[model samples]
Target chain A: MDVYLPVAEMAVSPWLMIGLGFFVGAMSGVFGVGGGFLMTPLLMLLGIPAPTAVVAGANVAAAAATTSVLGHFERRGVDLRMGLVVSIGGVVGVSVGALLFAAMKAVGADEGLVRVAYVGLLGFVGFSITREAWQALARTRRGEEPAGGRVRNDLAHRLPWKVRFPRSRLYISVIPPLAIGFCVGVLSAIMGVGGGFLLIPLLIYVLHLPPSLVVGTSTFQVLVMASTTTFLQGSANGGLDLFLSGLLIGGAVVGAQIGIVIGRRMKGEQIRMVFGLLVLLVALRLAADLVLEPALMFSASPPGAGL
Target chain B: MTGLFRIILAVLACALAWVGAPARAQNRGRSAAGIDEAVLVTSSFNGARVTIFGTAPTSPSDLDVVVLVRGPDRPAWIGERQRFFGLWLGQKRLRFDAAPTYFGVASAKPLGQVAAPDTLALYGLTPESQLAVQAGDTGMEPEERDRLMREYARLRAREGLYVADAAGVQRLPGGLFRADLQMPDTTAPGLYTAKVMVFRNGRQLDSTLMTLVVSKIGLERVLYRFARNSPALHALLGVALALGAGFVASRVLRRVSVT
Candidate 1:
């Protein structure tokens, strides 16, 4: 059924919106990311305005994270101390990122430059994670004992303000997690994403967080960041549509629950491999857009548009 | 007997004029026109046909009826993509200070056949003529502005917001005529003005102006107003709704799965 979106001022099928939310929410639950990297573009393809699509994507991600985090808590997989520390840095980082984004726009930075940068970054991250995950998977399949020891004398350990996180069994400095969160936040604000994809890798490889606690902790951070973004985009830009958000959240919450169940069944390495593939796919899609000839050369919009 | 016949014919014409007078004003000239209904935008609104029915004093063969409907104006820009480093990048936009959100016109015959280009341009009959460019913008030549204006009109036409049909108006016996202009679903809700012009042999003899309101009502109106007026409150509500729904769904789903 079609319903008119108040803020977007367009008519769209409710079922289509809900279905999109469901798919993205499932990805969020399984991967512990907000999935705005996929949702925003899909909404735009459906003819919703860019700002409205971004806000609605954030709104749905927040709901999906909330639903999955509860499941994670029940499973005793969440590291509350770590989640809180990262979220504090995330909030500050997002604010700084928004300011930086405005400054870049003022300088008339070419949009093509940003896209090229994104393609390069995603390609590097996706390739490294996939290769690492595959090697680990192959070693296990060959009946070889997995490498269990991690180097403890890294820069993360050498930082100041060391804090004991009994949940993850780490006596590491809070600075690394905060800094990692800060970077994720900056990227999320600039790209209109939840930053879960980047956060997962940082928690897994950089912080050496326990695999059991990774998904839950990442989800908690995503919930915080997504909620902040939702509020900021809605209030600052006036693009949040309650009716559209309601439809998306309605589907996302249920989908997230199912995703949590699915995540519980999969091994951590397998999940990482799947996430790596997804990231690489997104990177490829973006690269193709940059390389291909665009169908439409002329565009129309109100002045001062944003991604 | 001939003189008496002429008097009778004059009396009939005056009666027809009185009968066809518009609701807002009495017909002082040879033509009168009014829209059948004011467009009301609702949830189920797709596109609507704005039907204008009227009478012309002369015979249908001698007169052509042209109708132009223009919606509220807003600021907009059209741009062509700029290429850099062998890649298509940002747009170089030209601004239209006040452009009609919806502009459509219909006539019994082709517009060029009905009136000269100067006359059509003078009345702001085309989208190109109506689009007002912002003055005092540097580095943009007049030729570039004209190209962008044409591009803007073409884009809007593709989106069904700008429409022109030469034979959209249908003429009936005894100087009666009706024109139906299709307003797409994308039409912005605001006050719209419909102008009905009567032309004879490339000259406009009479014109009538009528206004109709396109507005949202009920839930649509309430929500649109709430979003615009209280964005902070709306944002809070959106977040709260998502959080609450998420929490409730998790709890309910857990119970269902366990059982």
Candidate 2:
């Protein structure tokens, strides 16, 4: 049986939708990341109208991240202070990005250009993650630490506005995390993703946060950022369809739980390698979409045929 | 003189009898398929058209057709009343805002009243009627069948053009009609039916129906399948799969080291 989603203005099989949610949720739990990067594209492929897909992905990400964050808190894995600082910067960045999006639309910029840009961005991010993971994997095979030598704790020392993060046990300037957060937020807004895949790497390599705190804190930030995006996209675009979100979130939460259990068994190097490869694959797919002709390129509005 | 007059009368009677016999045969063709066989086709739109075609009988009579559209899918109704109003505010519109699911056409005039039924209904070459071909015991040639199909498709395309009911029915220059079909954005995706009715001399004769299917694919349908169904690819990149394998490999290596 098909259920009509009023907000999205489409009829969908509810059971199938819930099952997809479960799969994405599982990936999120296992990867220690929000699965928006995976979910959004998949939704688009399934023919959910683009706007609804973007907003609904954000909402589902927010919900799953919320559940994951609670688990992280229990493990004392989150750096609450750091998360808050980053979130503040993220909110500002998102506002800027959203304003830019509006400006571009007003100027009548071609939609194809926006899509090309998105594909390019994802491609770049995916390749970089894949490269890093491959390198890490090679080093582990030789029983050696990754060649990055120790992170430059020196860079943190020199920065102004230094703050103490007692939980991570590092006295680092707030500049790095805040800047990363802001940049990720802008990218998230422009691309309609949670930016967790981007954040995990930045936290590990740039901010030099401990691996345990890295995943937890980034997940926390993703939750907050995604929630903000959900609300903003919903109110602004009228794109948030609760019925669709509910089905996806319901599945995602269960999948995430299973993913986390699976993730616990993997070594750090293996996890990094797998995550990197996933990014690269996603990037390649996006690149192909941009460079190649789509099978059906015609634009169509939601069923009922009105734009 | 008397003999000549009788012979002329006899010839006139024979001529009249021959004409009368054919006329009765033609009338029988019209009566066999009573005038009440109307057909209807509908869709989830304010205005949609249904077309009906049959062989032209040996004789032509007035063709009456009426179009009635209704909502709610029960199929057993005939001759529902519909009002036609003049264009309102300079725009033609259906009385109701929503698209009606059932529409029909009925007319009482003899087919000859408008034009030769075949000439009026068939814009291009009218192929030998299927009945004629069958009665001749000669099946349609492959080329003929293909040509018929193409013609049918073209006719269908032409018939599909419609404006929303709000636009009312606009008559084209050549006895053709068009109406705007107002399909609401929130209209649910499903099969909708359209019905068409034909009449002769103010009496219903034949009826028929067809269906329109509306379908949609939403986000969840796209994303989940990619992740779950493509397990080979997923296994290649899945962090969990890597993690599980790594765990097992590490355990094996530890045992080897100890041994």
Candidate 3:
């Protein structure tokens, strides 16, 4: 059946929306990312206005994260203290990022520059993660102990204001997690993403979080950020489409459960390899959009179309 | 013979007055025109087919009927993508102060054949005439601005917004004529104007102006209004809905798996 989205002011197939939600939500569940980077562009391609698409994507991310994070909590996988500290920094960073976004928009050079930076950053990160996962997998295949272990001599241990996280079995300074969360928050605002991809990698490499705790903690952070973004977009920009978001969330809730089951079956390296490939795919697609000529050259917009 | 001649003269005088009075009154009064439907926008609204029916006093052969429908006006912009170092960068845009969100024209004959181009423009019968470019010193060349404006109209036409159909109007037996204009799914909801004009020999003789209201109704109406009036409350409602759905789904799925 076709459902009319009141805020977006369009009619779309409910089934199609649900299918889209399922696909993106499953990926979010497996990777512990909010999947905004994927959902926003896909919604826009389906002819939803950019602002409305962003709002809907964020809403789905928030809801999907909730389902997955709860499952993680039941398993005792999440580090609540660390997640809270990171989220505190994220909230402040998002506000600062919004201001920076406004300034960049005024200058009108933000899109091209930001896109180039995104492609470069994603490409480097994806390559390194994939390579590392491959070596780890090969070592297991050769019957050798896996190489990854908690690094004790990193700068994270030397920083002040150290606090112990009993859940993750670590005593580390709050500065690193806060700083990482702040950076992710800034990127989320500027790039219109959930910042889960960046956060997961930083948690593993910088803070050396245990493999079991990585997904849960990252998902916890995503839940907080996505909720903040959804609320801000709805109240301040007035872009949220409830009818659309409801359909997406319905599919996402189910998809997230399936994802959790599938994630449990796979080894950590397998998950990392799959996630790296996904990020790489997105980077390539974005690069192609910039380098290739668009099919439609002329663009038009009515008043109050975007935030 | 004189009595018969006087009666014939009286009949001829009456016929002349009947024919001449309409010609004189035509300039002052508009011919009758109406739309078949009130155009209510419901949840299943894909698009609407508006049938305009009217009667023309003049002979069908000599008269051409033109129907134009325009939706509400809003500010708009057309942008041409600029390139920098082989990469598509920002856009050089032309802002229009007020442009119709929807514009459709239907006529018995092609618009160009019915009247001179300038005349069509003079009466605001063309899309070019309806778009009012914001007048300012934007440092853009006149030719470039004109090109972008035409492109904008073309793009809207492609989207089924600005439509011009030559054979849309049909003449029936007697003086009855009808025209059908299709409103696409993307047609914005607002006050709309539908004009029916009578033209002869490239000159407009009479025209009637009518208004139509396209608005959301039922659940669609309630939601649209609620979002606009109380956005904060609406946001809270949306968040709660999402969170509740997630919580319920997880719990249910877990129980099902256990069984």
Candidate 4:
């Protein structure tokens, strides 16, 4: 059956939306990351305006991340104090980024410019992640020992405003994590992402958090950031469509459950490789839009379509 | 017969003058245009079909009912992308204000053959004449603005928001005629006016204006008002809703896993 979205001003199939939600949700479960980058562009391709798609995609990611954070809590891997500190910075960054988004929409640069930037950003992240994952997988298969984390520790020690996070058992400057959170928050707002994919690498390689705490911290931040993005976009641009978000959340919740079950049996390296390929596929699709001929040359959007 | 048509046209013109002249509507029996009622836009308002039924005089085949349904106007800009330095970017953007959110024209005959050019402009059947276009005519001629506006109208038409259907109006027996105006799902909520013009022998004989209220109602109204009036609270609520869903999913997942 078709459902009419009041805010989006369009009627779309509920089944199609639900299926997409399931797919992205499952991907999130397997990768232990909120799949906003993948979902946003996918929503846009399906004819949802950038504004609605941006906010709705974040809504889905936030739901999935919240579900995963519970698992982290069970394992005693989450550092609440650190998460809150980073979240504060992330919220500030999201507010600033939302303002920029509003300005961009006001000037009507929400089409070609947004698409071009989306493609470039996703393509770079996808390529780099895929290369690293593939190399790491190959090395493990060849029975090679994993690389040491010496450089990140040295950098962490050099930074100012040192603090101790007892939960993660690390004595490092709080500046690096706070700055990272802020930057990731901005990128999440602009790119319509949950910032989990970017955060995981920084948590693992830069701040050098334990493997157990990295995913938990990433999920903590994603849940907060994605929720913030969803609210700000809705408040600023009136982009949140309850009907659309409801369908997505319904499917995503179920998909996340299935992902947790499947994740139990899979190795970490294999999951990373699979996620890398998925990200690469999304990147290729977005790039095709930029390079290929468009069927329609002209398009029009309503006032304050996004913020 | 010619003298009779001239007299009738004068009376019809006097009666049809609804704009800025209410005193002239003194006639009890005159060519009038009205719709069933206002379309109440709710949450499920995908689109609506407004049946605009009106009455005319004399022969039905000889008379043409030209209904111009238009929504409230707003600012719009259409950018033309050209390959610049190995990247496709908007080279020239046509900026214009007062572009209708929705514009649809229904007529018994093609507008080109039904009414004169000046009459169509006065009635606002064409986008170029209807909208107040503001473009940078620095290196381009004034006609460029006209063509650009036409292009803008064409784009909107392709999107199904702007429609011009000649065969849309249906004649019902006597002098009664009706036109079904399809309100697209993408149409914005506002006051829409439908100018009903009756043309005979390629000349405007009589015209009447009908208005359609496409405003949000019920849940749609409440939600729209809340979002517009209290944006911060709305946004915070959005965040809360997402987190609630997330928390629900977490609990449900654990239950299924335990079983």
Best by lDDT: 3
lDDT of 3: 0.81
Question: Model 2 segments beyond 4 Å from truth?
Answer: A149-155, A305-307, B1-259
Query: What TM-score goes with each of the models?
Result: 0.91, 0.59, 0.93, 0.87
Off by over 4 Å in 4: A98-117, A149-153, A303-307, B1-29, B33-36, B116-118, B134-143
Model 2, span B89-125: residue lDDT tens: 1111111112222222222233344335464334211
Best prediction by DockQ: 1
Q: Interface RMSD for candidate number 2?
A: 23.9
lDDT of 1 by residue, A1-307 (tens): 3666656766677778889889988998898988888898889877787889899999999999999999999989899999999999999999998888888888878365567767887787788889888988999999898776666899878988999999999989999999998999888888888888889889988999988999999999999999999998898998898888988888899889888888888988899899898889989988877767777878886211221
* Candidates' RMSD to native: 8.2, 19.9, 9.9, 7.5
C-alpha positional error of residue A182 in candidate 1 after TM-score superposition, expressed in Å: 1.4
What lDDT is obtained when candidate 1 is compared to the true structure?
0.81
TM-score for chain A as predicted in candidate 3? 0.97
Candidate 1, residues B165-198, lDDT tens digits: the string is 8878887776667777777666788788888876
The model with the greater lDDT, 1 or 4, is 1
User: Second chain only: TM-score per model?
Assistant: 0.84, 0.26, 0.86, 0.82
lDDT of candidate 3 over B1-259, digit per residue (tens): 0111121101100000011113456657644434423566566666667766667665536777888888889888998877888877667788888899889999988999999998899878889888888886246797887788899999888877899989988887866677777776567888888887877777877787777777888888898888888988888887888788889999999999999
Clashing pairs in 4: none
Q: After superposition, how far is residue B98 of candidate 1 from its true place, in Å?
A: 1.8
Q: Model 3 over residues A1-307: C-alpha lDDT tens digits?
A: 4665767766677788899999888988888988888899999888888788888888999999999999999998899998999999898888888889889988987877778878988888787888888888999999999786767777989999999999888999999999999999998888888889888889888888889999999999999999888887788878888889998999999999999988989999999999999889989888887779977888888322422
What's the DockQ of model 1? 0.31
List residue ranges in candidate 3 displaced over 4 A: A302-307, B1-26, B32-37, B136-139
Model 1's CAPRI class is acceptable
